[model samples]
Target chain A: MQSLVIVAHGSHLNPESSAPTYDHADTIRATGAFDEVRTGFWKEEPHFREVLRTVEGDEIYVVPLFVSEGYFTEQVIPRELRLAGWDVSEWDSDGLSADQATLVAEDIDREVHYCGPVGTHRAMTDVIVRRAESVTDDPDVGEGFGLAVVGHGTERNENSAKAIEYHADRIAERDRFDEVKALYMDEDPEVDDLPEHFESDDVVLVPLFIADGYHTQEDIPEDVGLCEDHTEGYDVPETVDGTRIWYAGAVGTEPLMADVVLERAADAGADLGTALDDVRETTRVATGD
Target chain B: MAEPTSDATDEGEASGDAPETDPEAPEIDLPADAFDAVLDALDDRDPGEPLRFEGFSVERDDEGEYVLADGDSSTPLDERDLHEELSERAPAVTDWYAFERVVGEFGPRRAFLRWIEDADGETVATRYAALAEGIERAWGELKITATVTDRGERRYDVRHADDAGVPVDELEAHEDPLDARKLVTYDEKGRYRPLKTAPSLAGGWVFPDLGPRDLYETVETIYPATVANWHREREGGLDVTHWRETMERQSGIYGVVKTWDRGEGHEHVNWVAEACCDDSQCLKRREWEYDDETDLDVDGGDGAFPCREPCSVVVSAARKWTRLESEQPRTYEFDLTPSEKEQVEAIIDAVADGRIDEIREADTKEGANRYRTRFLRAKLFDDEGNLGGVPTEPDEE
Candidate 1:
């Protein structure tokens, strides 16, 4: 039997952080593509240590529902999953990218395939592009809009900025929008500097985050001058310093994310079984019908 | 059989060719396969003898083929028919090892299974029926329900006991057990809960359908190791590190706790237990004392789970109190009526018992009511906020 385990950084304070992981798991379970679909969190229940014990299938596919290939995806996840041959000591020296290749490990009796984060999947670019177009009512929304892809970047990990830049570059190459720029919450060219990078007065800020937690809801909105203080809901097309600022929700919250997760699992060599039809066939055979 | 003779005449009798028959040491053939192995375990019973084990009954037919049935049932069934029937009635009986693996061998799962099955007394069919109807049990702040699905698989539902009467649709549904971690982080008043086992968990959430493992994960997430620790205490294997030992092991910032040791007698430690380990403060029964030989005067609470040692919160608070106790004592004269002094004591008691929130603003008769306490502060305090217009520190004349 095959299983899919979606690993995400769940929050003990904000329930919204792990919402996408659960939503995607439910979507996958409905498909009946795998014998079992489960979720593991770094800061929550069925913690990384015990998540593996919950799996009954010998062949498992693990997909990290993170926005970037940074410390969590490369080091913490592999270490917590106890994936064989994962050396934490070599993390700094090797500078390994967990998304560079599919990590296959013989974890005791099971064969575990560690896939890349859903946010870094190539299909995520489409999700981001769709998010940029979602905030306005224009038939040709991208024709005069400047799309700013926002990411929670830190000097501690450059890969976070790289993921946003990669998506920004891909979106720009399509020339769907008038202008595309990458912005970060921590690094230079911060989200507040969105107007400085774009010539278009009509600018759209899309946070490349997994959920609408503090960053997407409070921090980004505050930084972009969309609100005076921390607020839950925001009205789009809010004017900021003469620039029409439109803010979209976090990219990971998009329903299309379910497809991206499956893509990540398939890329890591998971056999995407023919949905519930196979289950029905097996049941029929077992009952001699 | 030969009659035994005395040693003096036994040599001639032993050598005589009537094969020496020992009544006590008969060569009996051992059983083969699981079926016979079970019969062998029934001791002293002849083959084809009717047998009973809890819910199951076994008997031999006229052809000598073993037939099994429910203890309450009259129809005897062959092995194949029994497997088919039990696969629906009690899947655990058909696959006992698999069931055990799913429910786990330790902690609440073991206790829950035993409670439903009556610890080997109830029939498997009865146990399965009970599971189908669902057995609800309380684990700390959680109300857990264990049930068997149509497929005979065990499923669980976990919710705050306070929400037991609430409709499932009204409560937020969570699939991942991890959601409980977030649910228990704060109380109803939106204050952070420093102690997970405190009785102040918020309600209005339910994990409506969870596997046995997920149920364990959810309970563990909410209360950490309380289940395992409770089980360990039940099994008489709980290793408790009392206040004295736990204090001595502290280092750095917490190392000062050791200074307030047995030298001050167990009075201070008793106060510590009364303040921190009370059922009102925490939901764990304090198993630790001043030492293995010395027990504190304070009650250790009647919690379902045991606190094997002084938790970090207790130790940290002790360190602060140690520093405060080291200060030189000075008397500050405060003019107050006897009733005022009694009111001060009542305020402290109310706050200590966490009943401050329960006191309504309109309840002015209560000494610790919001308006009453405010009035007391207004009447007694000076601009510097000292009681009775007196300075806390000595005035440098």
Candidate 2:
């Protein structure tokens, strides 16, 4: 049997950070798919080094629960796991990045399959729709709203912005709303331009991130002028332009991504039919969905 | 022998044995009403767990009595009905300022409310991922999983097409059942026309698009077993043959390439392919035609776009495989002198019968990487007994 070690970029200040990854690992383990499903993080206890030593399995699969291929995926993760691939490259997307197969070391006694970041999968668009629909409250009013997909855009890489735009285009193609646009924290069509971007005053902004870290909690709400007090913003929406802007939690934290994780394993050759069935049964018992 | 030996009272309290005086509670406000008010506060705490107050405990019994326990002494505080007395001593919190101070007095609720105050709340993905997650788990119950097609259309592969929960049979009659794409029509301005009202197009074709709400409602109303179409199983695992057939018809971004290990010096050759890149306009998705015999693009695009670069997916994979063939150390198959080979074979045979974890316990060799310290450490072999090699894209129909 194989083991899966999901590596997440956790936060010390925020306890909620890295929560989704751990929750996902639990669901996958319950499916009885892999020999073991363990989670390790950079900021939290049972860090990567400790996790690597404790988890048991001959065939280990390490998946990064990040939105895009950037600093953490390329640098911090490899250094912590002590993976033996090129550390840096000319392009941020270059080198042993997420969503690909990379051998850890030449003579490691076990086979290690390193997978891509969770945020890049196209199926994620569905989760985004769920987030948007949740706070829409009134589907009648939502019919006239605009969707703004906000991301942590860096001036350095175009790939980050490309992912945001790609999802926005797909959501727009669905024609659920009157208008849809992709905006960024550090780039053009900034989130502050919300009122100007939409003809309908109502808007729904779903953060395209893996966790509700500093950015989703503080930066986004502050930019939208919807912060409740000095510090944090809840998943609930606030009014902007006299219209409600339903803010959703990060997209990467959803349970549907667990299926994607299994898909990653199956792509690397771990059979998951039995586990998938078991997991579905368990979920049915839990929610009757 | 002034007092008969009594089990109810602490024997050491000889001077304070009188029932008129109460036991010492925590030092603070001295009014008797305030103390009773604190006891009355037991109504707020959950009954399953006992709440400790200083050295004493306040808990609600299963019979609905608020019992205050001081060591072995148990007082049914609520049975005594002291709310009127306690209400007078407890601080009034009618105003906002008084309420703030009163809240400060609440140790556990304050902490809980503090967390609620600070919480950034759940992300949209979490709420929705849950919805999508439930659908996947209950796929058999729903009779279908609503999935996004490769072309990004949302549809379902109803378990029984004719007896589907949705009007799928009627919907499929207008469009190709195999294609599963919605029928859409455009108005003169090119805006999408509504299916319910749009006029017939050429050949009497009609716009029959289903909105997000309509599709979900229809599925909830009728579909029997909706399945999620995952990336690896792009066809929701229901139609593998057809899915594979479709994949084979399109251009792929990567192909398994055959290469020789020049560095290994064992006359080794291997077959490799690019990890399947799903980019719609993947660098390898060329319009140029490949030779049926050679499996390589023999002709430049006469009109269609052809593949250009080796691609990040292929280049990275190629780099990895090449490194594996060249670097570090070999564990599964290693070169040894003819004389030492027989002893190694004996060791290998001894370890083969048991599980890898158990066999690794008695061995004394340090592995070549960071992760080996935790693993049972064994190499996988194919049916032919050869060491397992690089992963290849799954076979198509």
Quote each prediction's TM-score: 0.61, 0.39
lDDT of 1 by residue, A149-195 (tens): 98978675777787888889999999988999999888888888777
Q: Give lDDT: candidate 2, residue B102.
A: 33
Candidate of highest lDDT: 1
lDDT of 2 by residue, B1-397 (tens): 0111121112211221223333321112224433444445556667745655323556777777767666798767664453432232222211111113333432222322222112123221221222222222111111233332222222333332122344543433332221211222232234332211112111112113432333332332221011111111222321122111222322222122223223333222113221222121121222211222223212221211112223233333554565566555534534444533453454454443212334455454423222332332233333434333322322310
Provide the lowest-lDDT 10-residue window in model 2 chain A. A280-289
> Candidate 1 A-chain TM?
0.85
Under CAPRI classification, how is model 2 graded? incorrect
For candidate 1, what TM-score does chain B get against the true chain B?
0.76
Worst 10 residues of 2 chain B by lDDT: B223-232
Which 10 successive residues of model 1 chain B have the least lDDT summed?
Answer: B1-10
